[model samples]
Target: MHLKIRHRTEYRYETPVRYSIQELRLTPPQVEGQCVDQWKVSTPIKASTSHDVFGNLCSVFAQESAYTSMMIEAEGEVHTQDAYEFIDAPKAVSPYHLLQQTNLTEPSAEMLEFFAASLPQKNTIEEVLKLAKAVQEAILYFPGQTNFATTAAQSFIMKSGVCQDHAHIMLGLCRASGIPARYVSGYFFAEESPNLASHAWIDFCLDIDKGIWISVDITHACLIDARHIRLAIGRDYYSAAPVKGVRSGGGGEALSASISIAKII
Candidate 1:
């Protein structure tokens, strides 16, 4: 499948910002089953690009002038394979390294016990797929119930969240079960609504013996394929957030974002 994606984010402040610096992980990459045909990034200030630990293309932006608003825009085209078996993914990091949990993704005792009851056997690809499906069925996909700071344990207790929360929950459970898992930030082209394209999923090291990886979308209850465009991989949302920054003097921030995905005929 071939598609075009446009993502835009804007921030408004009651008082103009004095200065700010930000790390942006907004560029998608060309990987197994996906080709970045053409892409561009636009920001309010000049930005520099580099690769992170997971080899994700990232950018650094800074502004010294007082500004009441800020915006970032990304537009791109990708050619994706309908299906792929990930046997050739880069294996630079040890699988065990993924088990180093973060605060937001720390599995609670309750979560572990829930996994014990729900996914008694999660050792094989089939079992993992079942776990993904089970998570989707268990959680309610509702907005306003979660925020950017919500943790996986909290989401587990609430049983309601969006894609980011879903990925964090799956990461916590999979890591607790001794599976090497990473968070994936990407774009999902929906067949129905073109308004929402930003997406999140999980990548677990299914077979360390053969360096095999499986992409799971717990929110969608299925493995990701050509429809998913990979942007970044990290331990949690903070690591892969499209924008993370500190401002010297931006009173209170009001943020608005929009995304659009459409098939390119």
Candidate 2:
């Protein structure tokens, strides 16, 4: 399938920023069964492409001068297929590296208990599917129930959150159970139900030595296929966030984002 994606983000500050630097992971990867026909980022400050520790195609940008607001726009056309099973993909790092938890993806006592009782006696692909389904049934997809900084424990306790929270909860439980998993940030195109085109998911590396990473979406309660276009992968949301920036001076920032994804064919 061919898809067109557009994402825009704006940051408004009450006080002008003295200087700002941003690390952006907005570029999608060139993986098996996926091809980037075109891609671009529109910002006042120019950026040069680079890769991060995880091999994500990224960029770094700094404001030329002081400003009260910042805006970033990304547009791209990509073609994807369902053939990417990561069977022969290059191993970037040992999947065990993801066992180390971040604040957002850390498993809480409640989550650990849930996994202990809910996970099947044997860990198999079917067992993983059951776990994913359990997570989906446990958490209601409510947008206002959580925020960007919400932790997996917090979301798991509430039993409600967006895709990001769902993904984190899955990551936390999977890693805690010795199942290697990582966070994925991307765009999902669903023609019938268009909402929150920007999405989050998790990829479980059941066998790192075999170079197999299976994409799973607990939010939608299904395995990801061609409709999902990955932008970046990291230990957690903070690491995979589309934009991370620091300002020497700025106060009371307000943020707004808009995204749209359409199937070209």
Candidate 3:
């Protein structure tokens, strides 16, 4: 399957920002299951800066904002390829590993406990499916209850959160349980809506006899299909934000982002 994606993020500030710096994981890489035929990144302002997260080095841009409006636009053609072996991506493939490698403090006691419990046991693709089912059954997918910043532990305690929270909780559990898992950010084509919003899920490396890596959407309760288009993969949301940046001014600000996607049948 072939897909075209358009994403736009606009920031309308009540006060002008003096300067801002942003990190973007917006560029999609051509990988085993996907091929990037054409892609481009355009920004109203541009600066080149480099930062090291875990082992991956990313080139970011810094900009000065005198205008009240700031926008970043990306357009591309992505071809869905076939799934391949789960090669061990360098710990640098995602910044999520940086947290563990750098020995950053784990956030919640509940998260730590769950991680500990999963470690001793071996997990399989089947187990992941069962876990996804459990999560779907456990959590209520109410739209308004939680936002992107919500954590997995919070969602687990409340049993309520949007897709982002569900994905994060699953990622943490997989990682803690000794499974190599990462967060995936993308768009899902749903029959109920013509326009698709940004979505989140987990990709885990299964230590089967052949050692395959599989992608699962706990929020959707299925393996990724042609309807899914991946933007970025990381440990969690902080690493895979479609558009992320920092600004010097606009201490108090308002921001909005919207994604529109369609299948070319």
How are the candidates ranked when ordered by TM-score, highest leading?
Answer: 1, 2, 3
- The Cα local distance difference test for each model comes to 0.84, 0.84, 0.67
Q: Model 3, 1-265: lDDT tens per residue?
A: 7777777878888778888777776666656677778877777766463434422234477665376778887778788754523454453443234224111113367655544433326667777777777677677887777766777777777878877877877776666665767777877756575444678777787653343568888877788776677777666787777677777767667777777665555
Q: What is the C-alpha lDDT profile of model 2 across 181-243, one tens digit per residue? A: 889898888877577588999888767678687788888778888888889999999999998
Candidate 1, residues 82-179: lDDT per residue as tens digits?
64345535645566788878998997888888777656255576777787877787789887899878999999899999899989988888888888
Ranking by lDDT: 2, 1, 3
Cα displacement (angstroms), candidate 2, residue 265, comes to 3.8
lDDT of 3 at 62: 69
User: Between 1 and 2, whose lDDT is larger?
Assistant: 2
| Lowest lDDT 10-residue stretch of candidate 1 | 83-92
Which of the two, 2 or 3, has more TM-score? 2
What TM-score should be assigned to candidate 3? 0.82
RMSD of 1: 1.7
lDDT of 3: 0.67
